[model samples]
Target: MRPAHGPGGAARAGDLPVLAVLYGRGAATPLGLTDTARGRCAVVFLGDLGDPLVAADLAPVSRTTRVVDTRGLTEAQLCALVVGLAPDGVVTFSDSLLRATAVAAKACGLPFHEPDTADVLVDKFRQRRALASAGVQSTACRLIRSAGDLAPALAATGLPAVIKPRAGCSSTDTCRVDSAEELAARYAEFTDGVTRPRAYVLEEYLVGDPSAVGDFWGDYVSVESVTRDGDTRTVGVTGKLPLAFPFRETGLFVPAELPADLVEQVVRLERRALRALGVREGVTHTEIKFTPGGPRVIEVNGRIGGGISDILKRSSGVDLLAHAVDAALGAFDPPEPVLGLDGSGRRVAFQYLVSPPSDACVPGGDELLDDLYDIPGVDLVDVGITPGWRADWRAGTEWILGTVYGSAPGFAELRITLKAVQDRMASFWSEVEV
Candidate 1:
């Protein structure tokens, strides 16, 4: 394979220069991607606001790579900033930024990944329809324009459905309704300018074990490889546990503990869905559910998933971001599956933060960390929440409180370890005062 190169063809693999743009702080996409890229990269942060915590995360890598802050620049101005860097390639974690970056890159005649892939990933309604056509069984969904259309949409798809914005990410603007009355009430919340019609998808709700949520609602389970021509190859499987509610991803464990036969089924379904979506290449984060009969797709994101990739790296020691960067630079080849960390000696768990109710104040940061660290086999604790950051009650779009990570000798031990972690967290929250 040819060495990975920058736009100017000056840098190569083991020495390739890369540029990553992040939309906001706590965005694992660019950070993970940059880590996978090793030290041969630079990062350009684009946003109106900045976070010191995020800057701290990027600080260690500042020695070898440039970190440009362009919070005040317009999109055009940002484009100029990016071009001036003369990066061999540019990558972004936000779909909106991806769209803007793609346009600017194309205008400058620089190589870039397909912009449609970002749309396919960010727009839930469009993603579902595309996957459905590919023979992937997905939730019936429609993009609703106004509250008036909610009734008709419900009539078409049935009740107990999910209402979400078309362009929404991270479960933002998502509502699960059980009745027409509930749907209307939710619609009213949107109508009052509390929620904008940025585009929304109302979907049929599938019932299943919450523990198996990712399997039930995810668009695909098999890890995929896409080419510049839009060809996809299913490589491996990932499993997700249920989020708390409304929107809080709990954790994702790699080498999904599913049976071998079931894993194959998920791979087949994912392949079909990727083809249907016209996804050629790059990383895809697809969620799938395993029904009594077989596996069905929930949704597909044309980019690598947030926590899963991180888990995969910890479990398998293979770097997905580097692979993606190589592919974008036209020097990547499909990789062989590296056997993840052996299950005999250890079990791994990746956790996301979920805040308690708003009326209830969570425990102080130090106390919370202290409790998590008390869990057996605890290895790392990444707390994203700060004093001023908003906290939620019940699971909602803003529920990532903090992550508790650890490993044990086996699954049972791992469960005990994680349970202890949870118990401590619960105790901490319960004891704290608002």
Candidate 2:
């Protein structure tokens, strides 16, 4: 564990409210969170990152930063740490840490999602039951702890079902099962190891309504909300690009292009799901898909959506990370963020992703990031690789090689820019078996 403060991190932040973030692997970069939170309050990035945030990472941000080492800490132990921090609020941008963090927050009497709500938020199977019991939407689901549990899961979820870890993030290890044989085979493969047993949820597959979103857009949209003591205020609905093969996300855009009625339905369903899960206070990202029957919830994540901060900040002048911290502290709304590149002019911003097909060597590495600037409307590009890695289909968006974030004046322009970038990017890779 490293020291909690860097340089002058212990300096007083002018008596501002203290916000302790349970930081780890999740949405929002350490810098992004700090940038948004600069003067609003003092921030303590507390958690086990297994390494200190490099000085380069902390160099730019002003104000005090308390980066504590919290490895090997239990909930009660974490609660003790929180008490020592003496924070006004506790929050996490991580889905995996949501539950334990909630327990710690509650013990400290800090504002956060309570334990029960946090449990449902992180566990897909439990969430499904909660929603169904509350009459939100009932999609058949079964939890499987071992291979022998497959029969009941298959019976309940049926063929063409979706299988995923009960509590996972960014679609990792999530896949669709098409047939009884494939379902059994997948279950066997997933639990192959005499490695410790794992728990997964077999769910009724949600077929996206192509007619609802047409082409180019994903059938699903995530509703972003800021909830305070159970009263949720919706920020907006985000649109997404069509998923890559086997359910990996390809991209996402801001201000989803939904009909007025559809937006109403998505928001209404999100509110119900949140209520059912009992998410009282948090910045949440709930994914709802429009299906043949109607809009249905895919899952409700308690923290900010992965990559949501980038798209939101690019598309609108909103700092979602800042909002999360403020929600934790109470209704501490600052003036609206400066929108767009020009402050007032807004654009159709997007986080376009590129993923390699399974069994293939990943494409161009970090070198190509330089070439990305030539693309029209391109603001930032980050392709995380040096090119020797193999693309595993099950890795989901976490394994995406790179992402391009930028904005266009309108949907048409944004669409054109996206296509051009995708086409240009594909040329960087010569597909080959890994």
Candidate 3:
């Protein structure tokens, strides 16, 4: 990566600080976000009531909270609404709303990624262009909107390249194509039978170091960072469990048991990437992999990583979610992540996602989950799959049936605990009949 490089606010009712959150099916729930801002400030949720995703995104509304419905409002109207709220700060956890939040924040004179930066943040094609233009990365990337574009994209990116929605998240409709024929097929599969074809990005795949990660772990890691007024602090490097199918994440642990040198290397690259992306404030989740050439960036997320807050709180007692709230409020005092603390009896904290096998209906139930609690080192089990539901690989990572949170003394111990859990959990999933 290469180097590259906001606010208004006022107290509202009760003379307390306020955080204006553009809420929907986003990173943190209303309940979860409200909890984070409880003592620090008051939270006002700006709900896009017209969006279908918001119905599931919102937890039950509480009496004390106010949900502002911004559906059918123009961008200027939304900004005016935010200005009227007079919040001390503004923030968003949803990828799709980053730009809208930025616009609103700007209207209210609060700190946030600028609208221009947010544009690049949400659009992969623009981000790649910015990264390469700034010498952060020189990876070849092309945006394709039709079947005719696939052959040229494949020719430019070469075999074993990646094809994913240019502006999508959670790896939905993502695939790896190793040949021109495969690329064409995947392109058709993604575009055919749909009224309007989605734009896609084709880029060279960065190879990972299998030896560096071992069999049970994925070949990548994520650097969780907090940037305040352009001064970024490294929170911690997170390691991953092996991926499911093409690219579904299984497990993630913090205080990633990496050597001091490698950890520093990862942090350095992360800082550069953040700078290249013009991130001046708020929290970021930057994924990187150990390549034979060196550490390379996967992508940079402008919000807290999914399932990361739990592991981070467990590992270091750091409330990353609160950091996002505080950063928006311009009152965040982030602590440098405690490094090399996994020695002696120190433990590694992890969040394990349980995804069902493709083309199967899981026999999941409350009683079936009860057996998971007894596994040593496994702290909590939360599975939402009903007795009969399909799990499709095409559904991507959102196809989660359950999640397992736990801690172990080290990587070796964590592996044993994970295997024990997976082995037992396997019985809950029944293969589909042909």
Candidate 4:
């Protein structure tokens, strides 16, 4: 374990809340939680990524890092480690570790998602069942265990259905099957990389309204929120810039360009769905679609939307990470009143620089970033993949070369600005032989 305050660190952030962050499943850079946390910041990270976050990453943020091999550690053992930290709260950003962290939080007597109910929050099949039981309009779903199980699951979900891992992220191993043959072919393709077979969910397909398709407004949007003691409040809604196939996210535009009334409807469904899932507290990222029948939930995530914390801050003037930690520490008050969707400005957006299909080696990231920074309205450029990395389209947006974030004065201007930057960035990559 590392010291609470690293050498020369501020003597315990005065009276601000101290948080034990189970750092995993987020960007390498420090997040709003680590940045805005007031008191002692202790991080327990699992992995051999030496000095998981380099000093350069932490130069701009405040946190104490403890890299541990948590692979085989029991929830209780992890809790004991966090308990020793004497933290006011224990929380995690990783989807893969949410249940364990919830358990650890419970063992430490901290405010968090209840340990018992946490599983349903991350397990897709269980989520569908819970939402259905609550009369929330989620897709009908069936659990798939093997090839033979697909027929029954397919029957339940219908043709042109969706199939995805019950416990998956980054849209990995997810697909849309339009026919029995396609299901068989894509099932094998989707399941190709499994080391051990896991339960999957075959769900009814949700077709979004085609009319809503525009330059950036895709068929769906994600609702950003924070909850406390069974009551949830909206942070804002984010629109997608048309995801890659098999459901790879491309970008998020905050304060989704929708009529104010429809955004309210989405919020209504989100609150009802969260209540249904028994998400008593913490932050949530719920994706909903503009279906022909109106907005219906696609899925709900019981954490902050990865990579969009800055967007939330830009649009809503609230730090979601700080708010979430504050909720966990039971100091559940917003520094500034959270803005409603209407109040959340329309300019904030984040765009990914995806790996193009061509056999192209992108220009050196340092050079490209310098070019991107020169673009007007480009506020932030995060290079995910460097120039030497080969692009593999078989994977999802995880292959994106980088991400760009910015805001303009209005929706139209923001879109135009992003398009201009994107256009300017188009020629920065050139093909290379394999």
Best by lDDT: 3
Clashing pairs in 4: none
Q: Which lDDT tens digits does candidate 1 get at residues 233-347?
A: 5544665545555545556565565555666666777777777766665566677765544566767765666665566556555566666666555455665552233544434
Better of 3 and 4 by lDDT: 3
Between candidates 1 and 2, name the one with more favorable TM-score: 2
User: Residue-wise lDDT of candidate 4 within 215-302, one digit each (tens)?
Assistant: 4567898888888887677877777776655576767766677776877788899989988888888888898988789888888888
Q: Which residue runs does candidate 3 get wrong by more than 4 Å?
A: 1-13, 342-346, 360-368
In the range 139-192, model 3's lDDT, one tens digit per residue, is 778999988888888878887899998887777888788888888888888888
For each candidate in turn, the TM-score is 0.79, 0.90, 0.92, 0.84
Candidates 2 and 3 compared by TM-score, better number: 3
- Each model's C-alpha lDDT? 0.59, 0.79, 0.80, 0.70
Q: How many pairs of residues collide in each model?
A: 27, 0, 4, 0
**Tens-digit per-residue lDDT, 1-434, candidate 2:** 11233334454425577777777778876787777777677678776745455333444443346677677888778778877777777888878778778987887787899999898888888999999999999999999998778888899888789999988887877889888788888778777864886699899999889799777778899988888877788876888888877888888887787777888898899999888888889888999998999999998998889877777776776778778888888764633422213335777788988776454645765566677788889988876775457777777887887788888887778888888887877776677845
- Alpha-carbon error at 358 in model 4, in Å? 8.6
